[model samples]
Target: MQNRSPSRRTVLTCATAVAAGAAGVVGVTAGPAVAQRRDSRLKNILARMSIEAKIGQLFVPYFYGASATSPSRLDQERNLEELGVRTVAELIAKYHIGGVIYFSGWTNNIHDPHQIAELSNGVQRASLALPTPVPSLISIDQEHGVNVRIGSGATQLPGAMALGAGRSLSDARTAARISGTELAALGIHQNFAPVADVNVNPANPIINIRSFGADPRAVGRMVAAQVTGYQRSGVVACAKHFPGHGDTGEDSHTGLPVITHTREEWERIDAPPFKAAIAAGVDSIMTAHLQVPALDPSNEPATLSPAILRGVLRDELGFDGVIVTDALNMQGVRTKYGDDRVPVLALKAGADQLLFPPDIGVAYNGVLAAVRTGEITEGRLDESVLRVLRLKDKAGLLSGSPYASRREVDRVVGARGHRLTAARIAERTTTLLVNEGGALPLRGRQRRLLVVGASPAFPTDDTRTTVPELARAFDGLGFRTTRLATGREPDSAKIDEAVAAARGRDAVVVTTDNVDAASPQRTLVSRLLATGVPVVHLAVRNPYDIAHLGDVPASLASYCWTEVELHAAARVIAGRVEPCGRLPVPVQRADDPDKVLFRSGHGLSYGTV
Candidate 1:
């Protein structure tokens, strides 16, 4: 799954004047009169747009393939006629799409930096060739850490909670700036990142490690810093799932979750980070596909609720920027409105951008028909399209040249300096949660070092693949290590094998992700502890596994399972680096749900190991 080029080297290749606009660097410097002229031009463009074209300007859809003339996945999925067009280039030209979102893997829209740069230029060229020539904004979800979409050759910085654990706003800013710089270089104008949801509920299925932490102030500080870093780096930063998607146990991608926060409580927990992002001049705020009865009593999804989007987010929070709807195809937003009405309702709800409708044609016609029938006013339609144009102008897309330098991709992206910064950030994110009887830091041991690894269940992965890399991480440090991959979740056979393998080892390290008290991972760790062998339980996703496992001999939370993060964890175990990361959220006592086993900001360090 590495995004390789024609050559077998890394995927970081592509270059020249990026976002914020210098070559691949975005620079939009305008005074009052300059701003006035830019707005005048965009307004003029809007005035000339036909009702059909104007509606298209409000939609940002994703298409399959790496070129203008390739096959499609969505066309087959929908069995629709409009999507029958060949290649994403055709989709853009045919629909006059205002924006395009790129995804790697299944969509195959991106492969390497060069391929992505070509696609960026190709799509932009297609849009500009139109008689009216509306430049489309290119965007992606390069959130870094576990939620990353773009792979290597890009700096994979620590996730939000990991940065929160580091407690350094400067590092946070640097990480975002580096990530933004590379993404902009690839011609991606918008980055759906810096998750602003305050993760108050540990059972929060989606936002756990994606959010900074539970504390309002901490989340706000990191969110504001990241937003500034991203904008300053020339990529438009979007603070998302507004009003809060942090407290709900259900994930909105599959199910509609309701947040019952009172207006006062919402202002306390969920509002601060968004307020901070707005203060920092975030370009957009994405609406959550969930219900907030406290904000809108009608119980409509936030994406379709005028009370929440127009009332709270617009009037109360004062975010004059573009409000983009979360994927309209998701069940959360689709359940209440049919395909035709969803796009129209989002505009009515104050969303300036309609993202990923099931069918782009259906969405376009829906909004167009709504305008013709007076269900939605032209004035309302004008507001959203104008905001989109302004965003384009802000990204220097309207000025000229949306193409990324194919040659420059290699030098600017995943450069040595960026990799070092990522490594340092990873080093600062290793939170030592438990260390009983000094069981960790197995240095210079005579016996072979035994390892039992398991992958996190949240993001599906096989620990067996990472075993060689893990062994190499320790082997590079001059230690003889034996490794075993017990799958993501171990059965009786794997556990028995792991216990048997640990008989004469210095220490046993097992990686856990969201494991529970009754889970097989708990049984594995307990068996390893009973064998008179030191055991280290590593929680690679959420730190809450320690609380659930209850009284493990030793535990550490890397907060993610990235190569750099795992290497940092290995260094800490070998006494190479001190674990400075504190708990971003409180770890509750398994026996008592009301009481905490380890309070927030708790971290253990080995002295003179």
Candidate 2:
């Protein structure tokens, strides 16, 4: 397995490594005119790159561990199985991979800002040692809010829906700027963020809170603002899950989701945000795994559909920046085809980068074999190569030593100023959905309070603090608060215990998430309301949690469960701050989801407390 093609290992001796803008980010328009303006260094490097090397420039995959030399046990097994390499250094030298992605899970590569900086420098060192050296494009999913990749030491901003609820484009820009600055300080150059999906479906299991909102125009504006912020912060912003994945009920990681929209409906609903992204000169766009039948009746996932990628995204939308596929290893892209065919299909379908291929050896060799057999033209490969090279140049990755000053990282990431920005944005996202009988503004600050119900740590974050955030915030504000943790969906035993705890408290705060409308969590809310203590329910994940629990005395929707959001919700309950955020997405009935319970922009504000 250690033996490779002569093209890979034979280049170990001496190869001329040529060392290599953002109007450079726009579409490939001019032929000779644009070629004339291209940097001499870039042209030289391209001219000298072998067929093997140019194909290498199109592949970006993830490797395990925090170091390039020492492979984690999982990394050793996976890398050895795939490429017969034990370390990232070996992987780089052997495969000539163009980039590496950092992920929070699936063998976890991030620890803290300093550790990330170190790991990034190590990866760069190995990549630069290649016979034809080029800096690796280090990327992450640091979308902030719920999908934050780095924890503990990095500032975590509220998610995109929180911004939509807040309805502030400037706040959204600030969040992106802070995230970009922090990530760039740790040597990460690209953020797969600003989830441009306009989430119109409450049953959407994946993109609900990640999307900005249900309104296509508003979501487009928010995405544009984020793109501007991230690029100005010197980090490339990637507008993701193209052709929209917000209206689907299934998770693409597990199964393929088919979107049935007419061409006109798609133009009205899904095309606006991506249009806004391209107009803002977003550096990259990620193809989704879902199928939009209007774009292509062939039933190919957008990642493997020429009609969707080349016809729609490239030709119609005029997005000539790097078109990256959403992880090739996903079942959505691989269920019909094996790993070998997926990479070749994606490139032919118009993807510039094949992200996280299941097997690097198969993907690399498959494309190589295709090019040799005249199936994939060298001109087609160069089209992607130029786009990628321009992106690298725009990101300043072409410069040497993509490393951060370790001492400065501590000061730059999670700074006091950034956290304050996060808190302010979070405070603005607090929406008063139901304040029946004026049951909120909890009257007095000094009272016995029971903070209970299921939020389940923002629904997917592994780095959530164990201390109950609502209880802690209320405790700080002079309430004698008791916290009761119900699982994401409360069980009968937990509901009964919570109801019993509510008996003696002056007020009970119940926070529910995406549990079923008729579950024990609903029983918990009912039993707490039965106690006749002022029940202030907080829908801490989705606003629809308040759709069925409408009988409660009061309800609020923070649309998030982060510490900052919980703190802001606590302040609203205490009347320390007015509830100002509006619902970004309309609330449908939990029992009958088609019925509108609360329209978008439905939020109540207390005039004078």
| lDDT winner | 2
Candidates' TM-scores?
Answer: 0.92, 0.92
Native-vs-model 1 lDDT?
0.79
List pairs with backbone clashes in candidate 2: none
Per-residue alpha-carbon lDDT of candidate 1 for residues 387-450, written as tens digits (9 for 90 to 100) = 8877776776654556677656777888899999888888898888888777777756633677
- What C-alpha lDDT values do all the predictions have? 0.79, 0.81
lDDT by residue for model 2 (1-609), tens: 011122322233222222223331222233564445555557666776788888888888887777678757887887687667887778888888778888766655776667778788777777767667776788888876677778778887888998999999999989998888888888888888889998998889989989999999999999999998888777889998998998899999999999998999899999999999999889899989988888999989999999999999999998878999999889889978989889999999999988999889899999999999988999999889888877776665654335566766877898999999888888898999878777878887448999887746542355453237788899899889888888666777888888888887898888887757556777888888888788888877887777777577688988778777889889999989899999999988876777889999888988723
Stretches off by above 4 angstroms in model 1 are: 1-33, 71-82, 456-466
> Where does candidate 2 have its weakest 10-residue lDDT segment?
1-10
